[model samples]
Target: MIHPLDKAPEQGEAGLLKRLLRAGLPVAPTVAVALEEEFLRLANLQEQIGLLFQGVFGARIDEERLFYAAERAESLVRESYLLPERAEAFLGSLKGWQGPFLVRDSGRSPFAQARTPQEALFALKRLYASRYRVEEVLERWPRLFPTLDLVLVQEAGAPQEDPGLSLKAAELLGQPARVEAWEGRVVRVILD
Candidate 1:
């Protein structure tokens, strides 16, 4: 089956990332698992949580109690199996990729950081589990739950040569900032 990330734009940040790459930006290559798949995983996880807790607490558990239960259930998410084909495709895409990777959330207020493959996989599981975290739930309580469907698996970019540029930019902007430089060229300006 064609994984959603294989297509452009429609698969969320994958499209934007591709466009950036084509435009000669310094972003590394990435692969992603679609939102639909994540939705299914989340739904299944919720069902499993219900089953596991129903006998002990019954179905009338309040949101606070449910949040606790969800935290406990997070460990199970690491064991949730990925489809063999999808796993193969994801791994295959990074066959010869060297250095560390980055597993990032592709949603509003996205965060990105570097990791090895094993670390990235663990992070991915945690990212999924984070959907039900107490703080996350509180943040999205009004929305019921915010969308957290996409994962960005990208090769780690080279380290900044003069990280002082970030400090300088922050000083000038009167806010935190990061400078992403590659091949002696300043590629990105991130403000915080």
Candidate 2:
């Protein structure tokens, strides 16, 4: 259920982006190669569903929404990891919340303040599906399409005081392997 890059050495700005969708990319071309490749890997394997949704939710979660959510989760996941320096800014704003909670974004967007569990589920589905139009448009001229340039605003919200610090601190307290790895990123990211 774990991937090599899932636990990264990066955090904060280099770790996250708060950018508009219609602006310039914030990451180096060299770094984007890895990002895009991982993105594509998820995209290609999405049809299988189970491979993409593990660890995020329990096996007992609603099967109906999970299937559609997994199929559409790529865009939100894409939005979450896009670097601030690499992603251009345009349109509405999207901010991540905590513990599978995303909200209080640009008004008129479906993801903002999901009212009920049903609303939240639908919001996630719609949010993930948001990028299909862009990709479909770009599909015609794949060569002309810019990678990591256009980034939408959205986050896979998690419940935490500070995501990088809190989660790693929790891990540092319990997991030896994770402690050594996260210790450095915590110091480098939080103290530096």
Candidate 3:
């Protein structure tokens, strides 16, 4: 049987993919680009699998290769984009080949729910930063924040009278005067 990696790149993507998987290569950039399309060419998809596996294995390529590659790919796809800032860090640490192979998820937010006025305000601020204006989020889901409720708890550390973002947030929300000051920058209003 021909080793998957040894197959010619042109055997179309299917044959090439089979070869690559059998050979245990990492993911390919071509595959990454194709991921946008609804359907994928198997050969190209195999390429991406190879590239991801390569990144995870680092220098110790041969030992425990399949196990490490699978774990790395899963972690990258699952958590990377959600917390983009930590994505690179996570990748870098994996390359060094130290520490536990798996990191457990401890499901607990210090402030569980946005019950209190302060919690509600913080939630809204984070929503604006991470979820609201993010291009991908908006592109994928258009009517995301049509009915948002913003409640101000304490004044965000903006200039006293200026109220920097607080006012702007209200305008963006299309509910300015509806904004009510609770404590500081926190205010409560429903998105109507």
The worst-scoring run of ten residues by lDDT in candidate 3 lies at 102-111
Instruction: Tell me each candidate's TM-score.
Output: 0.63, 0.23, 0.16
Candidate 2 wrongly placed segments (more than 4 Å): 1-111, 134-136, 139-192
Predicted structure 2: lDDT = 0.30
Give the poorly placed runs of model 3, Cα more than 4 Å off: 1-48, 54-63, 82-192
- Judging by TM-score against the true structure, name the best candidate: 1
Among these predictions, the greatest lDDT belongs to 1
| Superior by lDDT: candidate 1 or candidate 3 | 1
Ranking by TM-score: 1, 2, 3
Against the hidden true structure, what lDDT does model 3 obtain?
Answer: 0.29
* Order by lDDT, highest first: 1, 2, 3
Query: What would the per-residue lDDT of candidate 2 be over residues 71-114, giving only the tens digit for each residue?
Result: 45555443443333322211111112222223322222223434
lDDT of 3 by residue, 38-116 (tens): 1112224335544644532344534365455555444433332223333233233224322112110011111123333
- Candidate 1, run of 10 with poorest lDDT: 1-10
Candidate 3, position 73, lDDT:
40
146: Cα error in model 3, Å: 36
lDDT of each: 0.55, 0.30, 0.29
